[model samples]
Target: MLTVQDHELVAAAIGEAETRTDGEISVVVAPESDSYADAVLHWALLVALLPLALFATFPDLLHWATAFVHEPWGDEAPPLRLIVLFLLFKTISAFLVAWAIFRLPRVRIAITPHETRTRRCRRRAIMVFQVGTERRTATRSGVLLYLSMAERHAEIVADELIQSKIGGEEWGEAMAALLAGIRAGQPGQGIADAVRLIGDVLATHFPYTGTDPNEMPDRLIQL
Candidate 1:
């Protein structure tokens, strides 16, 4: 678990900015981040390492391939170094791992006032596959965004944070409407949009999301 404070990077960046400003300083703070652990590991790296581990643990496998290297220019063949083999395996594994991840069609979304970036992470069905055969599936990264104090700019960050554990798309759309409302100075509609989206999605089959603030079964809302 690599725990990083949201203020940690901001502080350092601000210090650098201030020093360069030559006594005039403006501090900037982006969104803060929370601690998270992940398991979407580099399996291809392991696949590459596995061979070298096996080689180190079993060197005789080299002999079979070395048989082809009996040319008179034997110095060119080198000593068939173990490190060379390890590095070769490492390099090949990197490409293969990237390729594998690229094929998995999953959706991930991150939104900010700036722009949104998405990626696909799961295999899609036939219809879905056609729409994203070239790699455009959306997946939930199980992420949540947290609000933080900004320094000078309305700074927002997407990486390195775990957001509120809510079903994002439904909630996110509602929230987008909410923010857009705020930007457009229609706070009432923003609130209403949020209420409607949250309420309807919750009341219906959107099982992943919670009930809307206004539609919370009265008793639940009261509580």
Candidate 2:
């Protein structure tokens, strides 16, 4: 959810970063890393089970409660229709509540495990690198800086060339910086700063040669 000005600032940051190194850097921001449907379903199922358990475990109690309310008509065991109606009402109410809760973005995200979110972000980042950034240039020196808004996660993926020169963990600082920005509610500034940091690293290992060609697009990708 970046503004036009934020997009322009990010583009400029990428351009400025590329000026110092042959390594091509790309930034991608996604609304979410994954659909998290599994997590939502898990929560929904738990909620739905509550109604089933209550009906199954306390049938006698429920019947008594219903009979108590209908005492004016003479105390009788709850009718089959009444029991079925109560069960259905409870079941439907539980599901409806679950649906509403899961519809909240934060609630769905909270239901997802941290490890799952991290893995999804990393996998998505790698995919973006392979399909969008990798091997596009002469030296195969491409890096992707990716952010997942919902997960509040950031990842760095470098092509074979860059990986050969620097270990993946070397980009930890940049990733941390990006995540910090996100945690602080300043994603744009965080990404911009991370780009600058990554630029510095690339420049150190792959100085811009006069023959370096701009083989990849410089603008930030929004997905």
Candidate 3:
């Protein structure tokens, strides 16, 4: 059993580890520590902001080399209008991108055969995600999950948000299946096949293939 004391609850929606459900077990793929906000912010700047900056500047910046035919703003007044409009458009675009990314839901990214249910703890009615096989409503507050454990140092796994209403026997059976692959003897069905199977399960819950809702399971899934 994943105990709160054992694993550091980096972030949770309610009472630490207060959620569970049948067929649902939370497995931590990676926690907030590994995936800090800084990374996302940096990526946004690189992918969104920089291109928009160039777009905004490109209009007036052509003075050094004249290539464009029609200046959208027209030069009748002054270059200032074009620069200002460019900046305004870029600013709006960047703002929208930031808002969209911030408001988007988060889901588990790695392996372990379990599901997660998280809600933004304080704003329980707000953003939520059911990181599981089939989509279902979960706690509606922002959440990042992990399976917390302790041996010598605290070990936090990435999918703590799995909500399972498991019968005791089923839970036990599932755990046995998980451990069976790791046990030393004969290494059940070979390690590679076992790992591949686990990866397949994670893909079902939270696909890492692409963020597009239109994307179906990839035929040639490299991951």
Candidate 4:
């Protein structure tokens, strides 16, 4: 969701922020934490199954409707095969309709709860940190700032060295600051601000060690 200028702005901010600290900060923004297809499919499946119960409970309506249409059914109840076929068709139709409707990102996001969104965001952030940022530096003071635009969620993950020095609650205000910018439709600015704020925090605990090497990238990662 960020433009080229925004990327440059954030990259510059990161470069500046890391200058006075031995800690490393990596930022990543994702379009979404997850596709949430499973949740949509679950909802769709439930909706699709509801019609089967309704049709089974009201078979007379079906029989009468079929007779009214002059269908070539025998003078007995609708056959089991017919009922199964009808329900199957209805279920398949319902599934297709639901899938089509829920394919919209907004609709999928709406069906996902805030708690789930937060959990998934955090999980993905941790995964990114583990795979990309954790222990990459000599001092192991790496930190990750992960943002999921679809969920409007932010997660900060710090390596063991940094985590041992700073409590998790201390990052709440940074997250809040980032989220405020995001809510204002200025995610790039929000990320830059968060980088600065986090840099300030890291600087406080791990002030510049003169010969410290730049061990990590300073560019914003978008996915």
* lDDT (C-alpha, whole model) for all candidates: 0.32, 0.85, 0.31, 0.87
Q: Which RMSD values do the candidates have, in order?
A: 19.0, 2.6, 17.4, 2.2
Measured with C-alpha atoms, the lDDT of residue 164 in candidate 3 is 35
Off by over 4 Å in 1: 1-41, 69-75, 81-103, 106-223
Residue 180, candidate 2: Cα error in Å is: 2.6
> Per-residue lDDT for 1-223 in model 4, tens only?
7999889988998898899899999999999989888889988988898877776799787666445543665645555566566668878999889988887999999998888888998899999999999999999999999988988888999999998999988887788889888889888888888899898999999999777899988999998
Best-to-worst ranking by lDDT: 4, 2, 1, 3
* Candidate 1 local Cα displacement, residue 112, angstroms: 24
Q: What would the C-alpha RMSD of candidate 1 be, to one decimal place? A: 19.0
Q: Indicate which candidate wins on lDDT.
A: 4
CA lDDT for candidate 2:
0.85
By summed lDDT, which 10 consecutive residues of candidate 3 come out lowest? 148-157
**TM-scores of all predicted structures:** 0.27, 0.88, 0.27, 0.91
lDDT of 3 by residue, 54-159 (tens): 6557845644222232264356745555545555666667756864574333422121112212211212112112333223323211122222211101111222
The best candidate in terms of TM-score: 4
lDDT (C-alpha) at residue 178 in model 3 = 37
Report the C-alpha displacement of residue 145, candidate 3, in angstroms: 13
The Cα error of candidate 3 at residue 179, in Å, is 8.6
Per candidate, the number of residue pairs that clash is 15, 0, 25, 0
- Tens-place lDDT per residue, model 2, 1-223, is 6878778888888999999999999999999888888888878878988977875798777877657556666635457766677667777888878978996999888888899999988999888878898888888898899888888888888888888899877787887888787788777878988998899999999999969889888888999
Off by over 4 Å in 3: 1-36, 52-76, 107-223
TM-score attained by model 3:
0.27
